[model samples]
Target: DQQVKQNSPSLSVQEGRISILNCDYTNSMFDYFLWYKKYPAEGPTFLISISSIKDKNEDGRFTVFLNKSAKHLSLHIVPSQPGDSAVYFCAASLRGGADGLTFGKGTHLIIQP
Candidate 1:
């Protein structure tokens, strides 16, 4: 089973519009959630993170909301921009640190003029 899943391979949105991406997890053991944005071949950069202890976390234009009961989470980007066009990955930190993070395939977000 997919521990973390981003069903959409891509998303397109107009500039200055709201962009929402959805994610679901199958494992109840996952407690810490994080989102990473990547461009091309570069490694993903941390966007925002929320502890299982908290329901939501926001940073400026980016926001992450978690629904623990549903085992789901989402990322919201306000006033999407062309610069925001890139791949976004949802990740979950397992109990062991040696494995790093369990990541979804990714969602390629395209922002238009």
Candidate 2:
């Protein structure tokens, strides 16, 4: 069974607007959440991460929020740009990320002009 899931396969947002990508998990053992961005022909790169203990984490234009009770998390990209158009993967790991991460199917975010 897929422990991590991204229900929306794609999301479109206007350029300079906020882009929100969502993820949900079935595994309660997960304690860390990480977001990764991937462009064509390139490996996924880490964008931001949040711990289960915290509800929110922000870095630059990106922010991540976790709802432990809901087993859900989201990534927000403010003033999204063309460069922000990519596939975003939501990953989870147990116990401060000591073990390997379990990744979602990925959501393709499209920044439109």
Candidate 3:
């Protein structure tokens, strides 16, 4: 079974609106969570991350929130632009891991004009 999950397969938002993406996890041992954006025919690039100890982490127009109790997390994008359109993946990992990251299938975010 997949430890990380992105329930919504896709989302659409206006060019200047806010876009919200959600993710859920079944593993309690995960201590770190990250969000990545991937363009077609390219590898994923890191967006933002949050540790289990913190409830929120923000950078620029992006924000990530974690809820350890519910084993859920979310990513928010403000003033979403068409350039932000991409496949967003949620990944979870332990503090130190040789197994690498467990990633969700991803959600395709489209910015409509």
Q: Per-model C-alpha lDDT, please?
A: 0.91, 0.96, 0.95
Model 2: lDDT of residue 76: 95
Decoy 1 TM-score against native: 0.94
lDDT of 3: 0.95
Q: On residues 1-113, what C-alpha lDDT tens digit does candidate 2 reach at each position?
A: 99999999999999999999999999998999999999999999999999988999999999999999999999999989999999999999998988999999999999999
- Model 3 lDDT per residue over 41-82, tens place: 999999998888899999999999998999999999998999
Model 1: per-residue lDDT, tens digit, 2-85? 899999999999999999998999988887889999998798998998888889899999999999999999999998999999
Query: What is the alpha-carbon RMSD of candidate 1 to the true structure?
Result: 1.6
After superposition, candidate 3 runs with Cα above 4 Å error: 96-99
Q: Which portions of model 1 miss their true places by more than 4 Å?
A: 95-99
Error of 2 at 29 (Å): 0.8
Which scores better on TM-score, 2 or 3? 2
Q: What is the C-alpha RMSD of each candidate to the true structure, in Å?
A: 1.6, 0.6, 1.2
The best candidate by lDDT is 2
Q: Mind sharing the TM-score for model 2?
A: 0.98
Q: Is candidate 1 or candidate 2 better by TM-score?
A: 2
